[model samples]
Target: MSAAPESPAERQAIDRLFNPRSIALVGATERSIWSIAANDNLRRFDFKGSIHYVNPKGGTIFGAPAATSCAAVGAPIDAALLMVPEAKMIDVFADLEAAGVGGAVILSAGFAELGENGAERQRAVAAAAKGAGIRILGPNCLGFANFVAGAPIWTTPLRRPMADARVAIVSQSGAIASQLEQFAYQQRVGVTHMISTGNEADITIADAIDYLARQPEPRAIALFLESVRDPARFAAAVQAATAAGKPVVLLKVGTSEATARAAQAHTGSLVGDDRIFDALCRKLGLSRVHSLEELIVTADLFARLGPVECEGLALTAMSGGMCEIMTDQADAEGIAIPTLADGTLKRLREALPPFATPANPLDITGAAMLQPDLIPTALAALASDASVGALGFVFDAPLKDDARGFARSFIRHIGEGFKAAGKPCVMMSHTFSAVNGEAREMTDSAGVIYSGGGVRHGVSALGHLAAHHAWRRRAAAAADNVPAAAGTTNAARPNGERDVLDYLATAGVPVIPARLARSADEAVAIALALEANVVLKIASPDIAHKTEVGGVALNLRGEAAVRNAFDTMLARVREAAPAARIDGIVVAPMRQGGVELFVGTMNDPQWGPAIAVGLGGIWVEALKDTSLRLLPIGEQDALDMLAELRGTKLLDGFRGAPAADRQALARAIVAIGQAALALGPDLVSLEINPLLVDGARVEALDGLTEWKESE
Candidate 1:
């Protein structure tokens, strides 16, 4: 099958669905039990737009005159909330199309989620909608809410509408979207848009993100993803969002075996390789969170304050124990809470008691409770410190009536201080009481925030916020330097080992000295000329994994041993792979005191060319310890990849082993990546197994390259 065209979301149709001037509520009824839930939500949310009720009975519904058919209504409907049954959907859609409806929210199940039979019917539904040039939100979804437009077509209950919010939640699951919406309300996280892309038969999560990216009202987008249906479209959408200076937080599931299966069944063909998805996220500057709660909280930070500007976090608290706990959590989350600057430290010392030490996670001591100015002064100093990226104060507000006055005062002081500092700030507490409605309202008014999930979640959210900011900077820098594409293809093109070595050598990648010989006498002559212990391996294009086929012999000392091993290798390989057309054998001098490493390239179907490095030899597969990065990477990127390896210490003279040449290893990695990029789409993969690295020396001991037949 040919590849699908790189198509963007139907923006006009999506706009009609979310920003519709007029809507038709199909299957509307006053009987109750969700038959008219969509209508009720629209009215309750005070949708500032026209709503046309549609029912086949042709009577009054929701205090509006109903029409039997959309065509009979004699007016154009921008969006249709189809609460009708699955079987009658085609007919209703036909009438809707005849009436020139632009979009539809199919709040019915029994479509693709059922089985192949249902999937066939779904294809027809998609075809009908496409033929009519209308967009669909779902075949099984709760619909969406355009809070900024005052349009809440969602079927689930919602809190009072919040206008002019900055975050748009785009989700694949209807229930999860609704749950997030409610969670946002509870956390006082204002959301401008909430979209549930159920089934994604017409409009997918990517479509929603793309549409939201172009909208100015939302400063951030939170995505709850099970899988990506169209990777190209998804990537384009993310790029658009990043270009628009919008932060997108993604909650991608399917890491577990059961979830992967469920994801495949839930959204047909959506369970892509999760690792590639992760690499894509890193490349695109999209923040990926594990849990829905983390998604909500992290998005709230972005929506409220935008991206974090600084790299270090400054924590302040009266209790040393609480400060220590917050510090530990911050470290665990990879959030750098740097030491206070000398100037800031001096200022803080002068503003506090003599006994108070000025440092990161500054302990202001209990005296700050009485001396209100002390806390604000310390905050101002920390906020102004160049090292501090963001600042947070740990405090609590009890819900008791007697303590209410103190709580209000504490919230007001913290909010006022943080606002005065002119930096992102948070008032944190060990309990959720610190985020009461009153507190949230106060912080919202003061342009501050209250994080109340204790030190764990509070620090985690801060870490995510910092990472989002850092990734954006990296992505922006890398944007100016687009890496050339690695020639790749879907067809199989096997390359012999000598061909791989020749290609790498031309590209400046270091390779062991080797010569290919077609006869035993030639092999003996080549080994004798090497003047040292040597390795011999069969060279055959059809036999990529030569070791598995018993085609390799190592450490042959003399000409006699070399000739005998060469003959024996040929015989064993022929016995193992009779169909393989053996070309010759490769002979190279054996080198000692080197760390074995694997460097390889892969053409991921979703992410494109990627480089992988790990401990090589037999342990490569057994340990499965490796690091991966997208291609077009530079020397620094290669070094970073190596640093992430679980066995990175092995290269640093682990267990009295000589330290491997890290600089040379990095250069080799870069060379491999550059070669892959130059190869472009025709190249399938290039692997250098056991790229032996001794002190200040690196050599590709064995190599393999695969490409397309066209190449």
Candidate 2:
């Protein structure tokens, strides 16, 4: 984890930057939309702090006398909103510093994002702020609003601060931040803070997370990230948030493999930026969502429910079609709607009509319309089920007909049932809709936790909820059970196939026994000693794919066959890759009829060491089916990776082959990761492909290492 501010002074400055008692709006004007919105928000939030608007022209703004500049305001400002153009920042910072400004939010564009010239200008601005001992929030971005503190320094229009706000939003894009806030409001999810870190000149998303995790109001944090500047800092912030019980729901943009780096091995070529991020999310237990709606909805659910103790979610709906839809969605989301306990099923059967059959996604049918009491009855029955962790019910919230209070009784009964059930519960709409004031009031008064995201997004949130709990548990266990490190002792740089396998063996990884053969006679002698059919391959540090160069001959028997194969392979490799240094032939007993597994370790520049495992050979690349996790992984983590593979059935002894020993395979994988870590950072990757597993025997068939330039 990354280290943070080392002193209380730094902590206090961050606190004052977001929740200041006094602020100055430099360059405030009545005509500009930004000025108008910023002023409007202060009034809307009933900001009690001193709000000083400054203009060099200085006459009147917002019906109050405007100061000529912050210096003229004659008071120390805890935070200053600089709304001037970039050309005038030099003088603006002078005036801000004169007034003892603690933090500055630059609301101008044309810096850092425009090219080299803009980057230079941004640097000058940063230097000026630093010289003045002031922290900067943005040099090109929207400002923030602290609703909990009634401080609105934002430059966009907003609805009233959400009551009982629990979710906080922080984004790299101001425009995206605005969209997220509007969507959160539409979903009736209250927000405590909305921060945008434009260009991240001084204060970045990592800093915001570090600060917000310690704040009291936000129950969950929703992030929209384009990039991270400091990975270690970001990781530390995430760890802090997780420890605080503040679930972080992430929405990142890049997923296309277009950004993947070209490398010499399959592991380096296949591991992309997004997959590494996904591995990071698993390590930190973050709820990573794909779209904007998913981001807000998942965060809302996370705020309502943290780590869950139970494993399943119990759902009910009044219509059979809605029940079917929910069931399908549950399956797609990997959410368990477990079978109802026998006692709970009996109770549900007793309460429902004779036609109703009790099941997981209980279908109350049309009987719920007349008998609203059935809502509570079903809730009580489902809540008692051992597998259920949470409950959800599907019913479209009234758009306008609710004026007659038609659904009031139904909502009231459901809410009362939820309160009595003593478990987290939410009522979702059958379709996506808006939650207007009246609808919000109805749910609030009846004590119903409500969502207007409808079935798709609502069920997706429950899926995220389950994943959040599972990830948290797994992450915790991984942290606690980290394998102790034993430094590698075999060699400094293990490059050739034999050398790589030898290094792995020192780390307790099982490797196929092999000896280097300088001549066909030596190769034949080694094959005879094994008393088994042998495989011969030309070993060269430069040649990664020995088979592609006609350098490999497998399943050779007898003296003539072994000798002929060795000679032919050497001649082919020397011709194909003449500059390569040949390490003769690697002769190992050919053990066939077993499952092949791919275990590789890659040292990501930003995330450090990580391991990936998948079906061996072509599937590792063709299917792109693999599971990745950060290094120092436990045996259980390896088992989990194997279980996640698309071709996992092949490991269960497909066809006539013996069942591959999963426990032994997992142990070998753990050792492989430890071996990679021991090689240190200069080694780019270590791959053990076709780690042939036949029953309880697991051995590395062939291995290679790619190293970076030595210091």
Candidate 3:
């Protein structure tokens, strides 16, 4: 089977499944209590669409008339929910297709996710659906349901009715998907769509996201993915979401090697290459959450508050000790809580009592909670200040009667005030059980994300959210133009040193002039023509590490020095590598520069071509500093690549030395990436070690390339 082309009309038709005019439940039966429960939920949620049940058993399901099959259904069916066994799914899909069904959600298992035989069966099902021009959601999936449309295709029965909100969840795991639904229900958070992309035999999480992005309801998307089958497609979907102003929060399940292996074994999907996946996510501007709880909380915040445009945050707590702890947390997470400006400080000082300190993370005495509106007043003053980007409130449980009322009133007032001011605010309290029922209700109704257990978790969550916002804005502004492709050429070079020079020069990398000589007389003539101190080294493709075998002799001043070093180097190399074939001597002018650098390219087994840049010379191993980026990177991205290196400070005039030419380095890196991308995996590795970088110039001192056997 060939890959299918994107069809805009077909995608639109697929969208109707989430908001169908009428639905037919094929193979619906009383014995399938799960299906019956879903039907009951539709009615309970006051679904406006018509529901048709097709069961040969001929009984009423949730008081709806049951048709024997799709042929007997009199009304037009927009979508069909199939709950039959795997063997009967193909026929059911065919019937639905004949009925002009726009989409079908298969609730059965035993497809590609099961094993080899199941994979073949899944292929056959996909082929049949494609031939009929029907969009099939799943063969081994839990099915999807839109809470906004009151669609009742979900496998698990929803205990609570759906609330209207801006968060949509899509998960590969059925259990996780159900858990998200329940979590939202418990928190009274609104959900637009909940999907479990089981097996992903045809429709994937990316496809679902693309569909959801068109909906005007959802402001954010939360994803739970064990593996990404098509990274390019996923990245495109994420980009689309970002363009639509919908933030995507991802909970990636497989972190360790064991977990990755287990995911593959369980689902027949690859999951181990986390580095490439992370790079893809970062490039595409996706928020990565570590845990399930964090996923919901962050989604809730993003959905309710929208994007916050603050440079730094202001933290306030009832206890001074808690403020100190939060300081450490903020420092470790790289969250900036700058000192209060003079004007803002004066306003805060005036608003609070005499003992209150006007600083970032202002710690009011515990007695302040006794005042009915003290916390909210402080938050309002801080949020109104232009210097504050966000506000954090911390306190123990509101125990006193007045304190409890004050907590409820303050949360309600602050929530409304933040909404009006368009600022983000978070609340932290250890008095989870002490708050009155009314106060708890106020907290929930206001949509405030709270952490009662620990300060670190709360601070970390806020810091991550803030960083994500910052990174997204930056990535959005970064240049996205694709770099021009570099053309290939063949150059004549009989020896290793000449070949290195030829290749580097062809790629616009400056290199020292070099020549190959069969005898010492030829080496002397070449050195005279170069008119500088020359270096001579034994040139042999078979010799990988030349210095180890005494094959290199540097800085030959004249004829006598060149002749003696040439003879000694060749003899030592021949003795060291007896079986190695030998090439004669390579003579080159000595190169001098400000700093030494290494740039190399390697083909990753999973991510294809990638480039690496690092500090060179003796400190290479000691520093172990390097930065890697996927190949075919743009020139601006190349600059970013260089800046990511840990030793980048050295290039920027460290220790009062002249700064190296960053633009020159970026150009060289881009050139290397173009070459690697063109040659592909056939060129195994390319290295330019000790590349000299001066004030505004760069030169490749030495380089090597390994080629693969022709196919």
- Scored by CA lDDT, what does every candidate get? 0.78, 0.85, 0.71
- Position 485, candidate 1: lDDT: 51
User: Residue 450 error for model 3, in Å?
Assistant: 5.7
Each model's backbone clash number: 10, 0, 1
Per-residue lDDT of 589-690 in model 2, one digit per residue for the tens? Answer: 988878887888887776777899987765677877788998878998999999888788888988877888999999999999988988877778899887
TM-scores for the candidates: 0.88, 0.96, 0.83
lDDT of 1 by residue, 508-598 (tens): 8998999999999999899888898988888997886788999888888887898889889999999999999988999889887768988
Question: lDDT tens digits, residues 1-711, model 3?
Answer: 012445886786687777788888888776777687667777776778888888877778667788888768877888888888888777776677668888888878888877899999999988887776777787777788777777767767775444457789999987898898777665455688888888887788888888888889888898999876665667677777878988888899764343243222211121124644565566666777787766766676667655667558888887788888889879876687877778778877887888878777888666464663565666776777776777777743343437446555656654554454457777766432333434445676766544442455556656666767776666556556546444444433223656776777876777767888888889888888888888887788787667889987877788888888888888898899988777688888876547887777765444455566778755555675666666667667777767877678878886777898898888877876776555544665676766778777787777777665467
Candidates in descending TM-score order: 2, 1, 3
The list of candidate 1 runs beyond 4 A from truth reads 1-9, 255-272, 339-357, 397-404, 416-421, 432-434, 445-447, 488-494, 538-582, 649-664, 677-684, 706-711
Candidate with more favorable, higher lDDT: 1 or 2: 2
lDDT for residue 95 in candidate 1, whole number 0-100: 89
Better of 1 and 3 by lDDT: 1
